[model samples]
Target: MKPARPWFSAGPTAKRPGWSLAGLPTDLLGRGIRAPEVVERFAYALRLTREVLQVPDDYVACYLPASDTGAVEAALWAMLGQRPVQVVAFENFGLTWAADVRDHLKLDPEVIEAPWGELPDLSRVDPAKDVVFPWNGTTSGVRVPNADFISNEREGLSICDATSAAFAMPLDWPKLDVTTFSFQKALGGEAGIGVAVLSPRAVARLDTYRAPWPIPKVLRLQDGKGFDRALATGTMINTFSVMTIEDWIDALEWAQGIGGLETLIARTDANFAALSDWVERTDWIDFLAVRPEIRSTTSVCLKFTDPRVTGLPAEDQRAFVKRFKDLLEDEGAVFDMEPHRNAPPGLRLWCGCTVERADVEAATPWLDWAFGEALR
Candidate 1:
């Protein structure tokens, strides 16, 4: 039988195997945000996050409001003016940040962009400019193959939106100055909260440099003259959902139980391998990310290359995606496997750590069936 709920949404992906609402902590449901027990659980989540991600001791990991969007904006609002900025965009989210820099922050940053499923020229990045880009383009399924493209002797900082890459892929902490992700991604936790990890250099930037514009209270890491150490130590800027915090703790514990980061990455890698094996034998489909090295193991995206589908107009191609996905959903074979609304017409499957390899394996044959049915 097919899995009961094959949640393949890019964010809020499948929960860890054997997870249920019954496993959550009940005592903290109605407690105040500053309750002693609540505070400890929040801190524990931070500690477990550090351990699971193997963050450097010199870095600080903190919870922030508004998911990954807030975290990225916070970094932008706090740090963009200290140096000239370079915004690298390969997909929608990257483009969003670039727009934020150019239009919102009004920084007039140098923009480096590429078509979907490709990467910008890394050599074009200047060390004197603060660099902003997504480590993994969730919509495009293209990831930076490695940190080698970044200069070790560079004077500028690397601020990465790692919403989809954090737990499922290996991150070189020494190479990233500010990295942000939401728990809803790889960990399969509840949404509305984001995790931001800052290197010592980033902390120094916050303490020393200030943006020329007014920083909102929610986005401020430092007051006019002093840094707010409390934000890094679990005193959040606003009231966050404590139940969501508990859910995140549950997810982190689940990650630790499964042998931590290496195990999580292996699971994602295995799932992607299973899907790739099937894709290789299937003639009608191909990866959106043409390069094997940069293909995302998390949001694995694919395009239908067969003439029957590609021959159609863009609108009809989108309809084909909807019909195919609907067939899978109707059969209970899959769920939320649709490509991102702004992405090119294709299928975007979540092969994150929380997803079971057996389920992915089972779903591939059904995909073949659905494709045939949709063409009819």
Candidate 2:
């Protein structure tokens, strides 16, 4: 077998070579008298995303101040201060956002939260009210079905956090008003920057709604009429990370070079298929998600199913999993396979296309080895 390239961590994962600033289109930031070509490149990258996802021409796509947190918070700050909020918390991070809405934003939000192991019922959500839901629960490895469930003519805004699902899955942009994602998830680009895509309705809300509390410098999006037009050009706020934005553009270019979004989706599907097949054959392991349809293809989480294995003390199970990660790293077969701290004590593997199939193939043996050693 060919040697494995180290990667597999979720955020800040391995990037394709020749993607640094030195190799980027220098004129994207525009040279002297051009005001940096990078801004236009950034706009172009957003346009490509819009095209790939089939976003409406009237909608605006722009980068945000920080990661998904920044974008989501900006959306909340811009759109929710006036209305009674409803938040759907399915995982740790989602719960964190709910807390932000209540504690930080001081909005008395009715929270519909499910235990970490399961997904909240979408039927319980009232689309007539402003709602916050992640398209894919990255930490929990659960995903929402689709946007068809959301009311098309609802009075309130539908704010979505699609950080992990943006490029990996098909987003119904028409049904979604406010959506945001970070490049680090499936894009494998740099962190510290986020992409915020807003439908015309969302822009209208931002333009119309005024928060009672002071809007932070980073979260402000209103142009003049309370609507955000900066989203159309590149960004609304201030300066952006030129280097990281260039990296994101290159990542898109690389995706296009390979086979575009369709090819990338297929690659993720294949990697998930490999893991799903392996998990089916193993009697000791099983998926955390109860339903196959709801399982996330990007972040595939697994737990020991054998009674003996599960019977081990919770701490012991966690230690065993940690040892499994250490063993895989020692063998140079995988890197950063630990489950997220906020999640159950189980292995959370990223089946992203950024990882070559050969590396995934070579890593399977190490999983067997680690499982055997831990079980023994």
Candidate 3:
């Protein structure tokens, strides 16, 4: 039987169990975000975020406009020109950032790229130059295995896009200068807002260095000379949705109630383990990420390795995926399990903390059924 709710989408993922509109603070609905009541709630949300993520004491967590993309672009536009940049691109989002630096920023960055399901060689990264890479590749299901590759004695900063890995995986705060994620990812909160955590070094860069290009008002994190400290205190650059703020707070509270980050990680580990056990027994499918250490626990990408399926043309393979996914959806067994268009034709199921282990266990048999049906 299908779970009560079938939501395995990657972004804007399933909300916390037992979530409802009634739980939101209705009194704060009509009030302005800058109003005292709403501001206090927003501030509390930031505090909860810090506590839940266990961010460092010197780090500043700020709410920014747009989802992870906004926070990422703001950091790039504000801080890329300080030194030579090394960009690691393995998947779509990372490639997008590289394109921004090469085409939009018009900077001659040294870009290192790897094919899908693999990571760039981290040992070759130049620590003397500023570096940007996604800690976890949501599209490819590969992640940086560890932060040991980063040099402690480096002169330049490390800017990490950790949208999918923020709450699910452990982050090395000391190794990262700038890290960005959205409430919509692992937290399963409402979208439209991003959270940027900056270290003291990143703040100093903002205070001392300026990008050569023009900075828009919305993306500016500093005044003429000094960093805008208010942005870290729930003061957004543009108008934001108060309801979304409330939902984020609710999600944080739910995380706390469920034993904080450790519990969340454990939940995801169990879900991934369940799927891995199923995959080990199932011969037709296998992990897209070739290396076990780099495989993502949250966004689990699987590829069809069955000779019958692999023998088909590219278009037929895509058709197989569509048919398989459609059959699952039609049975109300699952939804939003389709791989990204640019990704290989397969399945990408979100195994984040919001997902239950039992659901993953139950869904495996359904996946087998769908695959068998599609083959027929």
TM-scores of the models, in the given order? 0.98, 0.92, 0.98
- What does candidate 2's lDDT look like per residue over 1-376, in tens digits? 4335668777766676345557865553434322645556667777776666556788888777888889999899878976677888888778988999999988889888887657788777676789898888888778887776688778788899988787788788878889998889887888988878888888888767788788888887876678667667774366666667678778887888887778888888887888888888878777887778778887777777878668888898788888888887777777887878878787787878787666667777678778888777
Q: Number of the top candidate by lDDT?
A: 3
The parts of candidate 2 lying over 4 Å away from their true place are 16-22, 25-34
Q: Provide the overall lDDT of each model, using Cα atoms, as 2-decimal numbers.
A: 0.89, 0.78, 0.91
How well is each residue in 1-376 modelled by candidate 3, as lDDT tens digits? Answer: 8767688999998898889989988788888767898788888999999999999999998887899999999999998897999999998888999999999999988888999998888998888999999999999999999898788888898999999999899999999999999999998988889889999989999999878889888788887666789988877788888889889989999999999999999988998999899989999999989999999999889999999999999999999999999999999999999988889988999999999888888888899999999999
The C-alpha stretches of model 1 lying farther than 4 A from their native spots are none
Cα lDDT, model 3, residue 181: 98
- Model 2 worst lDDT run, 10 consecutive residues: 27-36
Per-model clash counts, in order, read 0, 9, 0
